[model samples]
Target: MTARANTVAVGYLHALLDYARARGLALDALRAALPFDPSDRDARVPEALGAALFDRAAALLEDDALGLHVGEQVRPGHYGALGFVAMNCERLGEALDALRRYQALVIDLGGVGLKRDEQTCTLSWNPGTDGPYRQLAEFNLAGLVTFARWMAGAWAKPLRIDVMYAAPADTREHTRILGCPLRFAQACYRVVLPIDALDAPLIQPDPAMRELMQRLADQQLRALPRGDDWLTRLRAQIARRLRQPPVELDAVAAALALSSRSLQRRLQAEGLRFSALVEQVRRELAERHLADASLDLADIALLLGYSEQSAFQRAFKRWTGQTPAQWRAAHTEPRN
Candidate 1:
């Protein structure tokens, strides 16, 4: 997807603009450097603009601490409200539910969803009406984990992050910033935290305040900013189809209530082919499954719409230079 409809990146750009203004930089000057049209209120700002902003901001600043300040400006009440919600919840599950409900309010670029398995609670992202932003997605995941730790009064342990995107060439900064097990190019953007984390009581709790925050969060979710793009809408539809594997293109078109030809035409207009997008989804899922050693290769292959394990392996190798096992070994670590 073109950068314009990437909510995470756009939100980060918005945050950067605000930061520059706060630092006495001219708003017009900042706008001039960006690709977005300042005069067009409805115009979508590209994700490239956000990337450029981050790169420039990172270079201009002396340290990464400035990024935290920028994040605060981007989502002002995010951490405070999370702390309030955690303290008020009766149990860890309740707190997680509250976090799921409120996370969107902090930034509507992407929404966070929770799934509980027998061993861990997985926090995943449900891309909003906007397409995904790789960097913004990374930042959001990192920020949420850090905020959750702060709320629980446990800053010593790191949150487990699994990303759908491939691992970057440079891992030192990412590892240093996250301080947790990092798996890249996974099937989904998620964090797998031990169930025990939920039982750790909050440092502060107030039922009345938590309820009030919940009300505020609900209101915010209702008023979230939405994207106006075919790619954004199509990505959401593709995500839904992944659950019930072996999705046919025509079926997806029918689900969107558009003719198959029309769907194809629309996707083409957006510079994307439906098949390519489906492959992208499969690649993401493959990466995730490959990282988890417990998941057998055949099972992962079946889940990703591949008929044979060899086919899945070949595809995985094409996506990343290394074999799936090699990639996982390079990324995974023993749980502390």
Candidate 2:
């Protein structure tokens, strides 16, 4: 993992540890089992190691939906200076704009983009050089979606979340975690919600806080470090795995040099299950296949871990609420 990836992973782990402590989990025991010093603010661990830790935590807790809980734990206040910006922004759009403007002050692996349609607003990511893990990516996206929804509900109307990701194997679990429509793939990774959501005023609307946060964010942006290529590595790993069928969790874990159980547990702690991550990978592959005119549906299905086309069809419907063919038709427009 690159420095950026390390920072993101560390921040996520920190959040998880905080949650564990609050939940009465044996933090010391879990910390001791981890590879890096949890207390060391500058401690840098391999991205793979960070991922392994996430997996181990999830499995150890025996909570397949741990990611959802983790998402819920992220509050605007948790982001420190960034939190201040979010809290003080006049509306959801302003807050998101602030996030987009200064996210690099917090994480380096990616940047976020806000895309709006007549009925929906989509927050998408442009992965930085150090590519991020699908789980981490999902966790980050889900956390933002959950936070936005909570904020919106507190202020005004609630927005429904729509997640577009690289599909995962455990479609059921992914649906359960998101508690909304989860599209495997069509184009980019995004969280879609109604445009009306932007109108919701933040609960903590203070112009002074917003100004203070803006100043703090400006300072942090100037001092942030830039290194590591985790996002690139993650993209390569996904592409490679998709090209090769039946990519097992254990194989991925072994490549990272950790026990399968440990890997699963750590991912759980980060708010991801291995199965969900795998499905995300598959969803991306499916989208790629669907976009290629030459690749038949059956062939794409086999490449994406489905034993048969029928199974793939069922999964596709569950993922997008539309058949593969239907999704392709809707998304095959020329971009300007």
Q: Which candidate has the highest TM-score of all?
A: 2
**Could you give candidate 1's per-residue lDDT for residues 177-217 as a string of tens digits?**
56778888654566777766656666566656765765565
TM-score of 2: 0.57
lDDT of 2 by residue, 92-119 (tens): 8777767765665545435455555678
TM-score of each: 0.53, 0.57
Alpha carbon lDDT of each predicted model: 0.58, 0.60
Residue 74 local lDDT, model 2? 82
Stretches > 4 Å off in candidate 2: 1-6, 9-12, 40-49, 128-134, 154-177, 185-187, 228-336
Worst 10 residues of 2 by lDDT: 155-164
